[model samples]
Target: MHNATVIALRTVATILILATFVPLLPFEAWYIRIFDFPRSQIFVLAAFTLLIFLVLRWWRYGIDKILIPGLVASLVFEAVNIYPYTFLSPVQVQQAPADAPADGQLSILVSNVYQHNVEHQLLIDLIQEHSPDILLTLETDSIWQKGLRPATDSFPERVAIPLSNTYGMHLYSKLPLRQTRTRYLLEEEVPSIKTYVQLRNGVWVELHAVHPKPPVPTEDDDSKTRDAEIVLVGKEVKGSDYPVIVAGDFNDVAWSHTTTLFQKVSGLLDPRIGRGFYNTFNAKYKLLRWPLDHVFHSDHFKLVKMERLPHINSDHFPILAILSFAPENKYEQEEPQPDEDTAEEAAETIEEGKEEAQEEDD
Candidate 1:
């Protein structure tokens, strides 16, 4: 409805007002976790819908030099990861050796390899060149799994759960994988691998490998369910005995509020802040980029080196990080957010959710 300039102005104003709520503490960004869909799906759709509606109205309103540019700038600011948010999060570091350390720190390679991508040799070459202690592969099917038999042979131990579905995952480790289990974070077969690894200095670190469902509109359309699964894991690891390390294709960006809460709740740190946002997805796009992959750790680990490996056949470039032990002077007393239960609000939200679920199930 390209009606009048005044109507367009009113529409733009409404969109900006809505965007403001995107970053509020718990209700806007984190509340999606309470739903059954993937968190990113909810986030991306909501963002695009709002953006498109605003842009169309602004065009119709016709204050070209002022309102339209302002709207574009605002969208860039909202989505782009600029300075201040640079690096990523507490991924900040204090010091490091100029040359490679005499003693090697544990290096972890987390790659989604894209189930349909057939450049297995390229991946193998990269793995051989890097020789990381652990490797995590997502979206691996029987065909992909069959291709990596040789690589798995090199590692003494591995856990493979290959499915034709894209949710299939596998992990190969050089060290003894003690009590490792393949866990589903939600109803989908998105598998997260958790196990303990003995580092060179005799310290043990708990590692969790994850591949949350992407937020795009497919079978799983909601982002709340996926986010809830991640939040649930963060809740589980609070006050855990060993240091923790989590890696995988989170399907969300580094700067989202949910990610920040995850870091706070688990007492983990991102290795990208002040370092770089090694955007791993859309390797083909020259400009449009998002850091959808991640490596997060508890306070005990000090980031040694982190980088985005060269692109293979997948839409995602691999991410690798080497971390060493850095014991804390005192553990964080911080409590995780999004745990509110005001009866009035919860009653309404819960009732609404039950009604929706019943409608779908029926």
Candidate 2:
């Protein structure tokens, strides 16, 4: 009976580990996304991480029913998190840059402004204070766009993809809106903007702004489609010589395999390491929180500072990153681990999606 109990506990641990991958999946088939799931990602993730502690106790007794599997699962899971710890408080932006160009370093702001949120003035106040060079807003319907029109005048260049549904997205830029193209990364009309921001230095780097649908029960939450779409974007950037910046409401935490794969596949650098984890979602609940929004870049830039802005009547808090243009060694490489086996699995999944999409078309 005792041995059975141990095995049962290990199985539970395994299920929790499975939750780590939930954010990577889509919302259509599975009911795992926050909107449809039984609980928040924070709760499931914490429980799974705790399970590691519980199963680790077997080492003391020399009993190992599910210990090995649980440990392996947890290790792989944590290895992929962008940053799981919340100890990261805000850091002040650098006062000045040596030989700073006249145009100054470019700054990007990402916010998942809830559709129902009415605090348009509050958001305006925050925007005026931060003044990002480029801004990406999610869940912005036509109403929200109208409310934001006043602010849009300040940044003449813009890309607007508004929807009455909660998935609408938009981008406004103070920099030259060079070569902007909107792609339906995961789903139709759920747009992701790929553009170039002409820097003050006369140099330009590619930018990919994405707001993948969270895996949920009622919504399109099967993250398989979402994950593949985002991964394909990373694949698009795999061989590009242009520095890349991919940011926005990923719905996945910093510590998930999907996000890590996005980072690895895109050759992007995460500054959170030796830094901090800035949890941006679930402003309603303190205990249940993780970094759902993110900003990742290529190593060509130096980390100047990153900050979390005040709540502006949205479910998500605004995350702003102030980065500088510094020449970096492109050769400082991270070995790609798109393991052959994993690629084959992902390929199979993609083929399945194509089949499903075709059937739906039929």
Clashes of each: 12, 19
lDDT of 2 by residue, 1-362 (tens): 47697677656656665655564554445555442222235345545655555656564544344455555555555444432343343321222356555464778888899999998888888788888899899999999899987777799888998988788888989888688998875467567889988887777988888886666655553666666666777778777777778888887766555666676666677666546667787877777667888887776676666888888878899989877776543334333356645555555545665555455446
Q: What C-alpha lDDT, on a 0 to 100 scale, does residue 159 get in candidate 1?
A: 86
Q: Model 1, range 105-213, lDDT digits (tens) per residue?
A: 6788988889989999888888888988898888988898889776667888788989877888888888667888888655545678888887766677788888876
TM-score of every candidate relative to the true structure: 0.74, 0.76
Off by over 4 Å in 2: 1-104, 328-346, 359-362
Whole-model lDDT, model 2: 0.69
lDDT of each: 0.66, 0.69
